[model samples]
Target: MARSATTIRRSTLTVPVAPLGPENPLPPLLPRDDPHRIDPRQRATLPPDMARQVGYAPLTSVLPTRLRDGYGRDRVPTDLDTIVLENDRLSVTVLPAYGGRVYAMRHKPTGRDLLYTNPVIQPADFALNGAWFSGGIEWNIGATGHTTLSCAPLHAAVLDGPGGAPMLRLWEWERLRDLPFQVDLWLPEGSDFLYAGVRLRNPHDGTVPVYWWSNIAVPETRHGRVLVPADEGWHFGYEHSLTRIPFPEWRGADRSYPLHGDFPADYFYEVPAGSRKWIAAVDRDGDGLVQTSTATLRGRKLFVWGAGPGGRRWQRWLTEDGAPGYAEIQAGLARTQLEHVPLAAGGEVSWVECYGPMDADPTVVHGPDWAAARAHAEKRLAATLPEATVDAAYLAWLPLADRDPDDVLHTGSGWGALEVARGGYALPGTPYDPATLGPDQRPWLTLLDTGRFPEEEAAPERPPGPSLVGGPWRERLECAPGGPLTDYHLGVAQWHAGDRAQARRSWERSLSAAPSPWTARCLALAEAWGGHPQRAIAVSLAAAKRALATQGVDPVALAALARDMIPVLLDAGRADIARRVFDRLPQDVRARGRFRLLDARILLALGDREGARAVFDAGFEVADLREGDEILSTTWALLTDDPLPAAYEFRMRPA
Candidate 1:
């Protein structure tokens, strides 16, 4: 047997990355704007204890993290910074610059990639920040949706581990929850499994909501089966509700098979406590990947895009025409991704997760008897890597969790440094280095050092910079002298804290001082939420007018504003106004795929069905089309009375 010690090395991964264009220059107008997400339905079905924690420490806004929807289909070869940890049996590739994603894991014995490795970097509107790519194992740590860190970087460093071995640590301060978390990865010589010790800590004086999920994507196979130690699971479908469904076979289809269903869905398995907590996606030969973790990580799930046309189209759109489809088998702290667990002040939770290939007897593993199949998996897992080993790994890592990172590999966002600067936090293994602070954090740092929020003119050409929605920032903004920038940002922080009335007042003051479009957009959102539709409409129109008045404005910025404004107008039955907004754009901008989508929408509303159909006939593609966005097919249905085009069909749920 080979005796190569666990080693960490700097590496480069060359893949095709569709460039993520500049962020929308507009501050998010909606107070809790989340048009890209699906709200979990049927809360009444949740038990009493589970219901109490669903909205724990919920985020009122995704402030500071701007949307990244400005990407196109064009791809170019790019080399990304990566950290690789390898031993005799396994080699793991981590992309520190891209959300610390475990980009690839090659099992040496089988010579196979355990996780679905995306062939290219294709940005889609699936994450909280508006851009995400499929494949690899991604650590989701912020909220119920795809994390704001999906495309963001993380601080990485090499650290000494047990017995002179080396471990790779990825750490970051999650801005939304205002908490710090870290993941340590290492592999032992001759061992088949890779180990990850994760911890999330809240240093504040009050409780905060925390959500974590290790999402592992595997190839979707016709004969693949996902097994969990549960008899019944909660099924969440786009039908807008959660229904109780039994495991293995549900509704005459084997739910464990990733391709058995007809629509995209989530099965939150009811893993009874004290049972061996594990999940695996295995082929017909009963050889594939298996994941097991310590007791703190209780939830197990299987997410699949079923065999439906929309599902098939989405599978193709995310990668390429002939790329194989994949499904996600995930584990989280709670029973489902829909809920968050609360961590008290000065409290933290830590656990260890293990991943490796599961090789079991095909007959028993894929047999109809559920208990026998589960027994086979658990038995093999215990023999291969016992829960005791995982527990010991967690215990050993706890003592070393506070050690300073020995060798800095890559630098992430400076938000952590700003947090540490404000609170004097003593986070250890995850150093929030002050050196990482860049232009974005300078304004906030000034507010912390000096006693005032810096002043800046609110104009379309120079929109508001990054926002800090933490409580301390809000308090400082309150005490600072009134100014357009100060008060406008204060309103956003206040709104994120759920103080709607006070937030509106702050915005009102900002608008009174400077009639800027960004502030007007916020005021419009407030009116819309307050049931004042007419007032909302008036403010929205003013925002558009203010935006259009600026000279030498960025076209991409204008496109974002128009995209958001047109939808609001159309939704409110003001397509004439929507048309007005669309017609004002430059001809080249209008010809862009995303705008052309709006063009078709507006044409349909004006009873020009032929024109709307003509837009589709011209064959334009929505470059940043969101996941599950059915507008193209719906518009086609309403206008042409013809079969939906294959290019436009991206429905993820059943008809």
Candidate 2:
């Protein structure tokens, strides 16, 4: 056998470690009258009188607020000096202030940091709710995607396990769903790897959908390649839809290699039915990192932005310009980014993943030869200390005995408690003023009653209504503040009732609260109907951009946004723009049978009646056009110079 390049040895010395740097404080809240104030439309569903009485703040305010000591303080740095773990070959720093994220990790042998470290600790409106920072290993738990708790502080401690092995432990209570999770980062003696063991416990009496994904970022390099042991995997794209494609090969390109100036792509791959549980990324220098976990960590994902202008802009936004942009190598508990694992109430799920450095020839990195590459990588990994040893070290260091159920500081309500729990006093020297909540104020009551309390008063019962549209539904929505969908329905009712102004207002409010493709399309239609066709086109484009920027991972939203824009663009007499929008839509969505009429319309608008007929025929062969039957029939009659029916004129009505 060839001599191993590096040998493992045991050591007994106090590891030299310290806080990596000063904490990066969360930005102070903008003044109430600030131009960027959370939109009133978001609060449109709330009863006006109650909204004023309780002084309800938007959900974004609770995010990025400290859960522990720094609560309510403006500019509280998230990087508190707490604990660091280091060995001869590696060093790891944990930030107790910033959701206990592993701030940075360095492989001593190569003097290279395996993880990307953002130079500034700035928060942006990037998370699902709002406010997130880029870089480091982000621990996400809750419903799928980046969880709400990703940026808040988590309970953290330094533990001594068997043989005095030091491990850094971080945990947080997912108060939104009442789940408790803990992560342990262990760098054992003389080992060149960092081992992580995660445990999620459901304390409720009923099962809940739980999502957990560890997002690891590394610098993007020209020769970078990601290796996952699979021949075929599920490809997730616009609208969260899935298509199985040959591994690492997408659209006739070897996606495992770095992409230069291509459209942005987010793909998740389900491990082949009997593949090993490991993924690795090799850089240009042939030095790389390998991450191996148990079968429970089933999903492997790659999120990339090709070296295109749009991709470069995102890179600059995430990091400073001139710095190499990074890519995410994510590990998830489910099969895809949108899929959530079902955890039984009172059940426990635990798994361990190992990260270590690897050196290999760059030629074997990118693959249609995944089997050969995987075999070589496996052989290299087999020479290291047994995985069981790392698992034992983690189990011994888990701080289960120290966990507190009432330790709810990592939640939205936990941030609220920082003020209300302390005699209802607001943060000192800050602009925030706690509302003098009354028994019937649902917003204030909900905030105060989170965690350990039960509600003191029930919401007033809404009057029974015959229809969700029109006056009765509008009145109910006004009284209780339904979310975006309810407001959207109200807008539709207003439009049909010839109250165009009110409809526009309702749609604007709906978009402000949650910018979804459906809501944007409705807003555009409402604008066009109200005689602002240019504004309608502009808003449609803005909505598509926002959907791509903030909710890029949502393929369904992207597809819907693209599909809805076709009609809006055509309505605005911008057939050229409509063509561009149509071209950008995912082939899967554009090829769907339901979109055939839309395809035909676009062709007709472009003066391609012959092509339109062909596309229409193809679409009809695959899809039953029940509601759309009239549009197609009329278009065909017109094409053949046949007599048109009275209903043909209805096609000219507002779509």
Candidate 3:
């Protein structure tokens, strides 16, 4: 017979005796026969060769150190063991059974360092052995193969320190369309990888159906928020609506959940398809946030979005306010993408995404001279970004991220939480805040409190604007604080692409007349967005100065507002200006919060994973707002390359 040889697993160190003959194997192997013969007195005996080997032979007598330690105790043989390798900057563990597990561990000795994670392989609760392959390469089989790989430049992984400890892990697995997908796991000695993944084979023939998704989890907490980028286009098989992105009716009707209830079924955000994507959620305090994207991957198109509370079939792993939160990338219905490797008899596909942790919001890029950095990145991506994909996809697909602004308020009367009209008041304590509008506007608060807009009563010519009920309502409102409530209308329009110059003018005038910090800040933002950087800076600085001048602006509110402004500032190229503001920030504002959602975004932009992870660790608390369900749409948009913003507008006439 040709010399037979035993296949050795290079990744492991076990030496198994192989190619033994059936007759005289190492020791006479026992079979299910000849245990006790019909003669009761006869007993089975070891074969002569086995007995000789067992009698104090060097191979038989030598035992592992662990066995020596537990010599007298009852124990089973240790089939597998892992050891951790601690170097100056990393800690890696190796497992005997799985080769190398827990591959990389990096510490940001000075600033935040970044690292990438390999895709997880979760097998059944027990089994755990998988191979890993890494590096940048393109295969030539599928229709879109090579062209797709050339679509985008690669983004490196980031590392950050979460509060001086290890918290976040990032991995960038970039892939393009029309390519055979191959992912392999690598195991080094002495490490046991935490999660086990199972590989599945595709059953589809070569028709080339596209599908796959990623599941990513973060620590969850009560104060978490999600942000997504916006876009404009119609690449996905759906239309956009003002309140909801319309999925094909055939896709099935989507349900709604209370903004403060459970996690949604499927979160989707509507952003412009195929455009520069950026979105995030900030902890109320602005300390942390996580930003991510795959738009830079060759041949891969990316959409922006997130999740809301309760709307889909599965319960969210996040506590309405708990630890360990997560965001996922999905393809098809949840069932379609799980371990599904589909291709023709020999076809395959691969996908990749990049995630960055930020200690602050991306909007606040001014302070650090990131212009050069931004320019460098932009130039690199521009060289390879596919013309076919740029700006082609707009709108976000985050359902949970798109809840109606009105849904936020509800002061329950006997009527329960109900929708009031534009400029309406609630029963009170409804998920929405009442203080948001001026008092004059409260009377006009959608009359649902009693009825629809009340008919006008005849009276001597009254000044423009609103009037309340009973006892000289007009005079009381005129005397009572904050200027005319017209700012609300202007604020809403400012949020849209309306005239920010005019809007800022209106909001500023009103704030000056009434003097509310919120109004002042809003007016400032409008000015900034409308090409009035100096004025915008002045406005916010004034508030900060005033607060400093007048007993420090409510530190908490100031911090919250500042955090919110970070992204806006970054987007507008006001990083330098924002730096000034950051320096003057209150001591309390600088203190860490429960979750640093905003911080993650900032860290991501700066490519500091260690810092980003720190913020994410603190910002893990995501509240269980029914609004979470709204995020599913965004999630869908990101995973499926669909572009549509939440609130697809359709001209409507009262039926």
Model 2: per-residue lDDT, tens digit, 1-655?
3322221122222222221222212111111111112234533443354234223222222222221111111233333453567777787766665566666778987898888776545454344433455677888886544555656666555554335565555665564344567776677666788888788876555776677788887778887887777767654432223456786666877877656326455566757656657777778666777787766787788777666544554565444447777787888876655545668866878788888787776666554487787677766666774545545654664543233332222222232332233334322111112342233233323323441122122111111111123243344444554455556656655654557688778778866776655566667765765689899898877765555555233554455456556777888888777777777666876776546667777778888888877774453421222211245456666455654322232121112
Q: Poorest 10 consecutive residues of model 2 by lDDT? A: 458-467
Q: Determine the backbone clash count of candidate 2.
A: 15
Which candidate should be chosen as best, given lDDT against the real structure? 1
Model 1, which residues run further than 4 Å from truth?
A: 31-41, 55-57, 456-460
Candidates sorted by lDDT, best first: 1, 2, 3
Off by over 4 Å in 2: 1-82, 366-368, 390-655
Per-residue accuracy of model 3 over 1-655 as CA lDDT, tens digit each: 3422211121322222111111110110011111011221211132233222222111111000001010111123232332333323333333322212332322323232122222221111000000111111111121211111111111111111111211112111121122122211222111111111111122223433333332233222244433333221111211111122332111242111112223222333344445443333334343322323334321211121223312222222211212223332222111211111234544323222222233443343212333332333333333433223222211111111112222111111111111123223321111223333443344445343443333242111111222222122222322334333544333323333244455566566666555555555566656665677666666766654444444434444555456545655655566555555555776645544311344444554555656654543443322211111233233223333444222211111110
Per model, state how many residue pairs clash: 0, 15, 190
Candidate 1 positional error at 490, Å: 1.3
- State the lDDT of candidate 1 residue by residue for 47-111, as single tens digits: 86676666455556677677787788888999988899999899999989779999999998789
Give the alpha-carbon lDDT of every model.
0.84, 0.56, 0.29
Query: In candidate 1, residue 403 scores what lDDT?
Result: 88
Could you tell which candidate, 1 or 3, scores higher by TM-score?
A: 1
Q: Give the TM-score of candidate 2.
A: 0.54
Query: Candidate 3 — which residues are off by over 4 angstroms?
Result: 1-502, 511-516, 528-535, 547-549, 552-556, 576-595, 603-610, 613-655
